[model samples]
Target chain A: MTTEKMIIEIKKWLMEAAGYIRVSLTNELTVSQKSGRTDLVTNIDEETQSFFIKKINQYYPNDRILAEEKGYDTIDSLTGRVWIIDPIDGTMNFVMEQENFCIMIAVFEEGIGQLGFIYDVMKDELYWGGKNRGVFLNEQKLAQPNDVSLSKGLLGMNAYMYGKNIHSAGEIGHASMGIRVSGCAGVELIAMLKGNHIGYISNLSPWDYAAGLVLLDEFGFKYSNIEGKPLTFTKREYFLAATPTAYAEILENFI
Target chain B: MTTEKMIIEIKKWLMEAAGYIRVSLTNELTVSQKSGRTDLVTNIDEETQSFFIKKINQYYPNDRILAEEKGYDTIDSLTGRVWIIDPIDGTMNFVMEQENFCIMIAVFEEGIGQLGFIYDVMKDELYWGGKNRGVFLNEQKLAQPNDVSLSKGLLGMNAYMYGKNIHSAGEIGHASMGIRVSGCAGVELIAMLKGNHIGYISNLSPWDYAAGLVLLDEFGFKYSNIEGKPLTFTKREYFLAATPTAYAEILENFI
Candidate 1:
């Protein structure tokens, strides 16, 4: 199928998924702790993942899936026709604030990103794009944010990392215009894409960064592990995404 | 005027002022530095303040005004009817992202808060209320948030205070579920009002905390200076506002 055609299909599915999630929000959510007390998942998250999986299987039968809730053990490498999904990127925010969480999906072929979608369900904003297609928020095309340096722009930070001063995260917060913590990787990436922040850093899993990395890349953002190494897409890693100058400054001075 | 009648009048003016600010956003903003580089003021801010002052002078000529841009020198005490205004809270956010900023107003009578209003321009959300009127977001009446403890909920923090670990701010952040910084006091207060955050701490002036404190008080929040004293509302002071449990916990354990 053509990229545009696939996007149209995916958008429909995403809107439907968001509708389900929104309706489910009015009902009681079955929440459970994941890695820790701070990490959480809800029944809605699981159902959303199932919704996406069922659609992909029904349509793209041969596409391998790696998602937050399931299918991770079945994928060993980023080989051909892989789909990465994070049904709910900010589960705690989902269960608590009912905002700031997102549904993210990225399609890859032979380790290259082909399409990406991050749906802020509550806001009804779908940020989606692909290689050579540029980027867009809902129906409007988005422009590339200015390449701002560390001192000139805000940074999105992991609350735990910033509080603990991990890797001098607090120092980096001081060096920038300031730091904002949204407690959601998807929301932070959205802020970065809108030029509200120059960079964002956090310990993120493959599902957490997959769709955002693709979208950010399309917007001319530089991203990698804190050590300036490429993400392996197989595990959780300390991640950083920023404009060129901020990325270089952070890697050289703070990280 | 009766309290209800005054609220209706204020709401009308707030909507009109918001309309003007929204229209001006499309034009080039006359931005200037205030106190430091991070502290900013724009022509819109000044114009909005002037707008409020003009209305107050025309309608309630005897009432005093304390606003961000002007009218501070003459108010020696809060002994009479007074209106405290932050025509544009989060001016930096306004000058940069154009979201998250708000116009805040608080009316006091005989040293007691009588009414409050916080209008989030971009989101078009108006959180307004008074002592005995109960709090509200737009037309919907809001309920008091759960009295969650420090360890159980998110905290809104000032980036500089959190980064510098001022008065153990970093330690407090670690004690909470997490911390969020929206770079805007009005936005943070809105989050706390919505139960998205349990607490918020920052150094603020009369205009910054005045409106929020009134609404928060209506919602059963506990607020005071870091030293556990009353806010004088005449100068910059270190402040904290939280649900009762979180406030007590932070004071007993972390502060």
Candidate 2:
């Protein structure tokens, strides 16, 4: 099938997943700590991932899967198509607030990112993009983000980034108009796409950021590790996502 | 007129103010900087304040008005009614994102907070309350927020609080589940009342937080200076607005 047909099929799968999520809000959720008490995973997270895995197998049985709850196999030669999924990106927010969380999916072929999808479940906003098509906010094509520096716009960040003084985040916190912490990487990415924030900076896992990289590329925003290296799907690292001017200001002055 | 009649009149005035705000969105806004380029004042802020002042003068000619955009005389001897208004609480958010801002109004009688309102304009959520009626989101009366400790819940703060490490904000930043920066005190107060946050900590001016104080008091949330003194409506100070456990934890450990 052509990529266009495949994308339509993927969106269908996503809608089905969202239906399960919205309908299951009242269902009892079982939550457990992962890396620590503060790091959490809920029963819905596993169920959502299972749903996507089932649909992917039914549609594209040969594709490899890299899911957050489950580990991924190394793509040493970058040969086959791989699907990266984070079922519910902000488990704590999901279990506690029942808000500000999303499902993220990214498709890559031969190690080059192709398509990305992020659905903010409660807000009903769908952000999708790829190189073949520019980024869109629910079918409305997004203009390139405003070229804002740190002083002129708000920045989204994780508290630990500043509390731990990583990469002089404290300085960046002081430099921006303000900071927003949504507790979900995909939600932050959607906010960035809408120009609600100049940028988002954090140490994120592959599942948290892989989907966003495609959208950021399509939107003409920049994303890279603090060391100024290109992002790779292989490992976790400190990454900076910023508009044109902020990318230069944060990279030069703070990052 | 009876106090009950007075409250109904206040609600009508608030609805009219909201109507004016909704209609003015398309008018070209003249923006200017205050303390800095990022500290903004827009034409709407002044106009909204003027609308309220005009309506108040037409209805209750003897009462006083204290607004963010203008100063007013104190009700000498604490004997007359005073309305405190923050015409556009998050001016930067309003001008840049056209969202995340609100109009706040509070009424005090003889120096005691009697009623308060914080309207999230874009979201169309109105939160209002007082000693007579308790707090509410739209029309639903809010239950007292969960008694979440600093370690188990999120905290809302001004960036400078954490960036400067004032009141041990860095330590509190580490202790909380996370932090959110909404860039508007009234919005943060509404978030806190809804239990999305354990509390809010910041250095806020009177108009920035007076409306919230009335609602917080009605909901049994606690507000105080960083030094654990009762808030004096007369000056700017580092303040803490908290749930039961967070009040204890932040007071005894962090603040």
Candidate 3:
């Protein structure tokens, strides 16, 4: 199948996985710890990830899979297609609030992100983007933020990043009219798409940035490391995203 | 009427007011700005606060009201009953995301809290408490958090607080396992009650603290100004709330 065909298939599978996972989450069940006491992993994350993995294996037996809750392993076939999935991105929010979490899936062909999808289960909002198709929130097309300066714009950052990394956060905050942290990346990314925020910065995993990156490209937004380098799927930390103008200013002032 | 009868009547009034606000919000009307672009005063807030004020005036006749979007005005008869209300606690969140905001109201008689009610309208969850009556999330009674140390507890603060007041936030974050800011005081208070967070610190107005204060009281939690003094209805700048044990530790370590 062509890359576009594969992406279309992945998007459909993601929606089905989201519905299955959301149903399981709505039912009250005991939760277990994954990384720490606060970092919980429900049965839904495992079940949904497995469901997607099985579908991918059946269709593209040569593709590799990297999933949260399940350790990553190499695929011997190495057909240049790898699927990265985070069944539930905001597990802490999910375990405590049962909202604000999402199912993230990204497909990379020959080490380039070909397709990215973030499915917000509770709201049933799908954010999807690809190299050719650009970005989309459900069916509507997405746009990058305006060329507003940082001081005139809103910013989204992780609460810890703002608190622990005061120097960087202050520089960004001083450059922006206000700073907001809603505790979830998928929500923040969607806000950025709508111009509610000019930029969003966080320590994100591959799955966290997968869908957002595709949307950013579609909207003509920019995403890079703090040092203004291109992002790689292997390294999952410290990424910044913004409109072209804001990105330049942030890079010039903060980094 | 007896105090219990009065409390029950007020609770019913609150639920009815919430219903009115909820119906109007979900009716597919477009939202407009009143204060500023980032600040949104929805019709729901105005209509709900008006409804509650009207109900209180009709029933009590001599009570005072201090509400957001409405200036404080004293009652001539001074029957010592005062109702503090935030028709929509997270107006920005409500306008942008239509979730996580709440209707907050607290009734005080002679400077003593008589009732506190915060309604998470979307979730149909009511958080209510008083000195005599225990705190509750819907029908489930809430208990005070265990004596978790600051190092192990979660602290909630707005991103602006960390940016503008980094010294204090840095101390708080370093002393705690993590920091979370959900951008809404009512939502953060629920997290505190659920033990997901040990404390929340913010520059809050009376309307924001009114309902939350009652919950803290009944749940055996503690709250005070940054200087560790009692919080008054007139104060609006800075306040902190936590489990009793965490409060002491925070005062010693951060304050």
Candidate 4:
């Protein structure tokens, strides 16, 4: 019943799920398209989701599930205990490189984030925390990244953002130390948490970033939609997750 | 000495230098700006070059060196035995993430690429070979990547390229499966070689791409400047390295 017990249980479950991904990585993967030719879905994505769904139904049946491949469109309420899961965040990266994709899950109770988990499968590094617990990478508690100015920090951006001149994403490109694109939302968000990148400018779906948003809030990061509005965990929007000073600099000069 | 004999000894030296880098990575690094605030030079960059210089001179004093930080910008000849070294290819990535950066070296004789070595330090994966022996990742000899079309491929691009539009880089974004940027030329080029990315488009100086070009050439990749000209290796130019079908498709549809 205790949050401490829940945290311990969640960590063990995450590591177990990650173990499945690692073992199956070398197996022949079946990949197909979603949305369009570029958007992809692999067998691993479906398998991982089924694994979580089966486990959750058996262990925590009452918890509402909003999973990427299934049950996402059916969610009309954020009430009760809701688990938002992105079984595989970077499916294309997974199908191709089999290196950068991740497994993400966020537990929310009555619309408040109770816990968040991001497992970088290839690296086996678990990033988890929310609210009172503070963010953590593996076991080490992370320190708050300083509010660095845009010019003093590198930016992790969506590659498409660079060409969308209307948003001044290209102008920000010239102002930062540099730009990097990892093609994975969970990994990019973790980079911002570690201070490897001061901010990430992106447009992502809910499953791609909900788990990361919880960790960002715990680390005191300024993350919001492009209009500087708070994320609602539903609709897709242009997102900016950043340190304070960096966020101000990007908004003032670039956006 | 035979080229075969030289390669055998040089691989040893490269691994030893990489060992030093691995050990010294955690030390306090002092960074200074070069060209502008964004371009950086760290003490490790200088130390690595010195380590290479001392070892090279001790082993082959008669050979010429054109290194990124030290002997670079002084080369009058590409003739004779010349070592083109980028002590650390992704300096900013090295300073920020302490990963994704690499040690790249290319050995040329009489304007011909004789041997090449790119050490992905954190992974301890060495991509090495030349005109004669063929490219190998670690001990595995790499086979040529299939000629996938542009629409089916992912392009690793310079984050800045997406905005330029001059090279139709943005158009290519729509044509490829997606665009990713690693902010490191050496690693990006390796990605292209492994088929994780079908191509890489960027404007890079010689040391930024030479060693990888050797590997690309051995792998039968088609690479050239934006105007479809050969790279002079003395100046920066927009470059494209891709599989056969992907190269042709990008050239026709986007370029």
Candidate 5:
């Protein structure tokens, strides 16, 4: 199927999935811990992933899946027709604030990102696009953000990285206008896309960053492993995404 | 005049002032440095403060004014119907992202806080209330936030304070679920009021925190200098506000 057609279908699924998530928020959420108390997973996360999986299997049976709650253990490679999913990017936020969490999905064919969608369910803002197709927030086509430097723009950060001063992030933060933490990768990436923030850095898993990698590319933003190496997508890696200039500066001076 | 009558008049001025500020966003702003590079003031900030001063003088000439851009120097005491204003609470955010900034106004009668308003102009959210009265966001009456503990709730921190690890704030942050920084006192305070964050700590001037002090009081949140002392409102000081349980925990264990 064509990328355009796939996006339309994916968006419909996203909307329906978001509606389900919203309704669930009004009810009690069955939450469980994954790695620790800080690393949380909710029933909505598992259910949302199952919904997407069922849809994908029905529509595109050949596609492989890498998702947060399930299907991750079954997939080992991103060679062809891979759908990377984070049913709820910020589960803790969903459980705590119910405002900053998101549903993210990215489609990769032959290890190349063909489509990406990040649905901010509560705000009803969907950021989706692909390489050469131009990115958008809902229906509004997003323009390329200004090439703000580290000294002039806000930077989004992971709380742990900032607290621990990992990779000299503390020094890098001081050089920027300020640093902000929203506890959600999708929200931080959205901030970067809209020019509200110049960059974002965190230790991110494949599901945490797949959609952002695709969306950021279309807007001239740069991203990579913390040392400017390629992301392998097989493990959690220190990640950095920033405006072109800021990205380069961070790598050269701090990382 | 009665507090209800005063609130009605003040809200009208606030709406008009917010409208003016919104309109100014599309035009070129005259920006200048205040304390340093990080400390900024724009034409909108000055004009907004001036607008409030003009309306207050016209309506209640006997009232004294303390404001960010001007009038603050003239006030020595919070006696006799004094209005404290922060024309733009997050000037840097306003100048950079054009969001997360607020127009804060708090009224004190004989050193007692009477009414407070925090207008998040971009979002059009007005958090307003007074002592012994119910607090509200827009027209919805805000309820007291859940008495969450430090370990289960998010904490808001000022970038500088968090980065410097001042007052064992870094330790306190580790004890919490996570830390978020929005670069605006009004935004952080609203988070606590809505139970999005358990607490917020930072160094702030009177204008930065006065309205929040009043509004938070109505929602049963506790506030004090970081050291558990009262706010003097006469100088810049370290400040902390949190849910009642979180407040006691921080004060007893960390502060």
Candidate 6:
């Protein structure tokens, strides 16, 4: 199948899987951590990840799978495709508030992202993208955000980034028009898609950036390391995604 | 009438007024600024403030009023009763996303806070408090937060605080469990009421703090200037609010 065809199939599968997972989340019982008192896991995260794995294996048995709750499974020498999944991002928000969390999925073929999806189940906002098709929120195509300077733009950043003094991300927020930390990277990415923010900077995992990176790339937004280099599949300590102009300004002044 | 009766009346009036304002926001036509750009001000904000002002006038003709959008107005000379109001806090959030904003009201008698109310319209959650009645989220009474140390607690703070290097609030966040900044002070205070966050520090106008201050006091949360002095009504700069234990920890290590 062509890359486009694969992405379309992935999008459909994501919608179906998200709906199932959301329903289950509403009814599933929660479990606390094995070590820490605060960390929690719900049956929904595991069940949802399993459901997606099952569907992906049924469709593309050769694809490698890496998930948050479930460890990596290597598939030898069949195809160079890997599915990265975060069944529930913002699990804390999910367990306590029942909102702000999402299911993220990304398919990379031969180390190039072929498809990406972030489903905000509670808000019913589906942000998806693929090679050549551009980014989309639901059916509407997303525009690259207006060319705003760092000082004039709104930024989505974690409050901890400021506290931890990570690469001056907090300083960038002070220089911006305003700062918003919504506690969920998936939800914050949606805000970026809607032009509510000019950029988002965070310390994120593969599952966190997999879907959003594709969407940012498709929409002509810039995503990079704090030093303005392109992001790789390897885990990164910091990533910055922004409009082209904002990215340039932030890189010049802070990075 | 007794103070309890007055608070109940104000709460009911605020709820009805919010419903009216919400409908107006949904239906009213908006116009752009002469600068030829979208300058958003929903009719809800104006109409809601007006509705509230009229209600206060009819019920307590002797009370003074201080409101956003329309500055302070003195109605009577002898009575030292004042109402601080923010018809719509988080107006940007309201105009852009139609969520996370709230109606905030606080009553002071003889220069002492007597009652406070914050209505989360979309979720139908009402947080209210008074000196004698304690704090409440809807009908449930709130207790003092757990005596978690700063290292074990979460904080609600503005992300820009770090960039500005103001009060070193970000450092305090680093010392905590994690940090969250929700953009809306009213919504953030709700998190504090639930013991989800130990404290919040922000640059706030009187309206923003008016309602939250009473709730914090009733729930045994302490608020003071960044220097650890009591908060005064006239200042708009740095202030810290935290559980007593967390406050002591923060003052010792971070402050």
Interface RMSD of each: 1.4, 1.8, 4.0, 1.3, 1.0, 4.5
**Per-residue alpha-carbon lDDT of model 5 for B14-101, expressed as tens digits?**
9999999888989999999888877888989998889999999998999899888854644688778899999889998898888889
Models sorted by DockQ, best on top = 5, 4, 1, 2, 6, 3
Best candidate, TM-score-wise?
A: 5
Proportion of the native interface contacts kept in model 5: 0.69
State in Å the error of residue B38, model 6.
17
Q: Which stretches of candidate 1 lie over 4 Å from their true place?
A: A71-74, B70-74
Which RMSD does model 6 reach against the true structure? 5.1
Better of 2 and 6 by DockQ: 2
Better of 1 and 2 by TM-score: 1
* Fnat, one value per model: 0.62, 0.42, 0.33, 0.67, 0.69, 0.40
Best by lDDT: 5
Better of 1 and 3 by DockQ: 1
Q: After superposition, which runs of candidate 6 have C-alpha atoms over 4 Å from their true positions? A: A1-51, A73-79, A91-99, A121-125, A129-149, A160-168, B1-48, B73-79, B92-98, B121-124, B129-147
TM-score of each: 0.97, 0.94, 0.80, 0.95, 0.98, 0.79
The numbered model that scores best in DockQ is 5
Output the better candidate (1/3) by TM-score. Answer: 1
Clashing pairs in 4: none
Q: In model 3, how well does chain A match by TM-score? A: 0.89
Work out how many backbone clashes candidate 6 has.
Answer: 0
lDDT (tens digit, per residue) of candidate 3 on B1-255: 787887788779878987786677658645566656656676778778888888888888977898886555223332487888888898876765566788898988787788898888787888887878888877788776675667766677766666556438557755665676666889889878777778888888888987888777777788987668877566566788887888888788777
| Candidate 5, superposed: residue stretches over 4 Å from native | B71-74
lDDT of 1 by residue, B72-101 (tens): 523689988999999999988887787889
lDDT of all the models against the reference?
0.89, 0.83, 0.76, 0.83, 0.90, 0.76
Off by over 4 Å in 4: none
Every model's TM-score on chain B: 0.98, 0.93, 0.90, 0.94, 0.97, 0.88
Alpha carbon lDDT at A255, candidate 5: 75
lDDT of 1 at B22: 89
